[model samples]
Target: MSAFNLETCARSNILALEPYRCARDDYKDDGTNILLDANENAYGPSLTTAAASSASSATTSSGPEIDFLGLHRYPDPHQRGLKRLLCNLRNTHHHTDKKITPDNLFVGVGSDEAIDSLMRCFCVPGRDRILVCPPTYGMYSVSAQVNDVGLVKIPLLPAPSFALDVANIKQALSNEPNIKLAYLCSPGNPTGAPLAKEDIRQLLEHPTWNGVVIVDEAYIDFSPEGSSLAEWVAEWPNLAIMQTSSKGFGMAGIRLGSLFASAPIARLLNSMKSPYNITSPTSALAMYAFSPDGLAVMHANREKIVAQRERLIRELPKIKGIGRLRGGIESNFLLYELLNKVGQPDNVTALAVYERLAENRGVVVRFRGKEHGCLGCLRITVGTETEVTRFLESVGETLAEVNGHDIVVYSDEEKREVEANAVIS
Candidate 1:
């Protein structure tokens, strides 16, 4: 089968439209001059940070009374320094100590912005279409629809696991000639299932899906194997890996997201993105977070979260309704089923329990009901051990209360049946 060419499947507006360019910065090089082009503070790293870095632990001051600097100027739009640090960090652990180049790195307001940029760059509103797996992140769909692009849905195979259907995706791509982009959420949001590495590699290798595959690896940090695609950005031009600092970094408030792709694609995405989208303070904070110490701390936290998640999965089943807790191969979130009337577990009916937990216990967990192929299940984020313990305690109380209510309702129905029989007699 012939693949869709630019002339065949390109969005009309995008093909015809002239590229938009923002005003050029006078100071664009990676240098240390007055540093005024992007309005960054001429000041360097914070004095407190310098002091802390150099001082011994015993001599360093504690608490929040630390002196900081460089709050008054605009941050680097390119985020070159931070990217260099991150590249080295990613290389040391994930790669063979080869730095991730600036061309392959793009830091945006958040992963949300990277998604939006991808949509804008590829989807020709009213012309081209995007393909997504069901029960995945909603942002892929939302961003496509917002851009006036059409969407094609290919749902995952159901439990005891929610695995990707590579055949179905291939079929969909062939069936629909208009698809310009394919969005995948690994360690999926609601399902917490990671797409199989082979499946991802297959999608990349397949001629039909070779255009653009946005792997939303937002929670990849918590996944068991870590990220496999970020290092392959240079090898695959059509590949754009979307990641966020919010999750493992515990800096969601900073709103820093990154896109890894070829330099040309990176430049195109940058063109599509809003100038000054990320604030100075945010860029500063993100740079700080990317520091070796900051990242090491995040890695420790991720390890802690993974441990806590395992504990939840093991301990949750002591409750009657929560028969057995299961999870995807990679992500930290867990989705467990409730015991149905036959004492057999029913995976599709946990929404009621989810609501009950939220209402009665003031606990909030994702209820994947009719929407995301989460038949009957509750999606709980992995929290700290203390938090998870508290959450499980609430789960126990909430389940008992729910079971009691169900028994009462069942009894009332039986009583009504008896009353009807008496009237008939």
Candidate 2:
């Protein structure tokens, strides 16, 4: 049991905010014919069968046909059905004894919305701050800036592991009472390393700090089983776990993200959010994604992604100018450095290759060279087998062209030796 008080931590204004009410609040639109409460285009959505077909196939789910006509009316602001389905999915997949309920969940446009909402709900603009572990997600910082919340920086413990500095984080929390939120990205964005549960527990159980500890498990599905701290939310009132259908479920287009927290925290977020934050179409698509067939498909696709990730790990270091693979293999992406002539990580070569891959080779990858501890690094998302093959060939060619020399292929033993001695720059 935690002694954290929501009213004490949340902004005074937010605590007193009277949420906006809409027509749906007064009258429920239970798919009745005489639905004239909310002013909507009664004629129905101007979408062709082709469009509906495209949408249905988007998630590869064979669920019920979408109600195109329902586009005229307002969507369920509460998203009760969606939340219930999500709860079931997590309860089964994560195999937790303490079952999750709708009251413990809040669905937003994306993880970005939940991130921004948490900042708005708890931290007062310009007065309060949120702590972030960099080489993690950029949105935490971006959302803080957008919300006018100050930031307390604590970069992850170097490369390879990219573990959280629990000691420094605790020290910062004790030093800064104004820090209302601490954002920890598990299987981090560019780092791809999951923060240890014990380190997170240290902050959660800190005797002094009462602020919320938000663990962003955006890529948890890609990591080993039982890695999520979602189950702990039941016990820790000051803890919130953010997950998404975007990554593993392949439903990014639906823009569905979930925040699992104490019932009080979840209710606060729901009260402050816009009435129809989620569109009808988005909800329809997401429902399909939560269906039994959808879950199977998602798991199958995840297996494919994991397989490709392993392939990249085994093969990427063999490339001539590519340095050692940085970060843990816990996400769909891989971060590796581009080496200069003397086998040193070089940002110049990384940027050049990034541009060439998109422009000349038609293979796009993100250049994360500017991020801390990620100099000369390119973040490559695992793609289809064919796509991976093309990328390997194209990147090798691009490196050779940039270096103005033929690529030096290495044997298994030589590759190991080179990787072992490669300098992290």
Candidate 3:
């Protein structure tokens, strides 16, 4: 094991480092007589966010009736029920080599907290460094800066499908003696492709990353199955897998996130986390959703989202000026790389297109500028079918207005042919 400078790693930002010792006076808020202390709603979970019950099917052919509730209480510090449900989904017990129990899991405010915690627990400030591959998630770098840890970015080799450069990553780990974390955001954020399983396995086996390898499966549900490196947690004590209900589970508003790791890492995370992390209502509702029947709803939703995502991919390119749609439909989000005559290999100015999309199309999409390596790309989240239709309509309108060309919506066959030709060329 590389000698980690324990003291430095422990010194996070003031918010993380300060001990929580609230005075009785501090607990008293100066407000009106009818004051609600924390400003949380007297009611719990929003009506739109609630999962349909077993006895009652809301999304049936009859009509669309959304049922939601409001909250009133602290959430469970340890999200016991939701953890079990997720474990069941992953088939944690079915592992032949290693047995994973609930002890191996820890729930956080969100995976953002887990990322911050990993930096706090592992990366020694000043001396130690953590590595991130560019064209990946930005949180890793942001969290490192906040925690005062060093960040080494090795841009993912864009050729041969934007795969991680294992050699460069290993070299960074070897050269940086105190390197503590290697972040892999699979089916990555803007690029939208899953890291090959074999490439991930190599990183786990590599001696340099015996520190901590965080596999952020934020978009895994959208990708092809059996691609997660989650099962490797038991085999590699240094590994941590981050999952979130926000993206796939349609619970992003709940702010629920999970960390799956070996028992030892789980213990440390639990010890460091703030008490009462999850509110009581959140836990109760999540428990309700975790029930075998509620899970069916989630799976059904996933299937619907996947289907709609495929439909979007097939239909997107017929609009003029749109080039290759670079991301995979495995997740709910699709990142399309636009073909701009002005877009250079490494220098596609995405913000100009982004501005055009927002003002001309009335669709809000994330534009990665030069800093993130996406020169002419726009990331669009997959919403409902109606939402998608509206989005495509917007795309067509925007293209027509921007380029003075007639918008030609392609049929399924036409779109596929274009994609195939685009790929071949």
Best by lDDT: 2
- In terms of lDDT, model 2 sits at 0.85
State the lDDT of candidate 3 residue by residue for 136-172, as single tens digits: 8888989998878888888887732678888888787
* Candidate 1 residue-wise lDDT, 159-276, digit = tens: 5466788999878876786677888887777767777767876776766643677788888877655364676666666677888889878899989998887676777666556666
Clashes of 2: 0
Lowest summed lDDT window (length 10), candidate 3:
62-71
Which clashing pairs does model 2 show? Answer: none
Backbone clashes, each candidate: 8, 0, 15
What TM-score, to 2 decimals, does candidate 3 have?
0.79
- Report how far off residue 53 is in candidate 1 (Å): 21
Better of 1 and 2 by lDDT: 2
Least well predicted 10-residue stretch by lDDT in candidate 1: 62-71
**Ordering by TM-score:** 2, 1, 3
Error of 2 at 313 (Å): 0.9
Residue 286 miss distance in model 2 (angstroms): 1.0
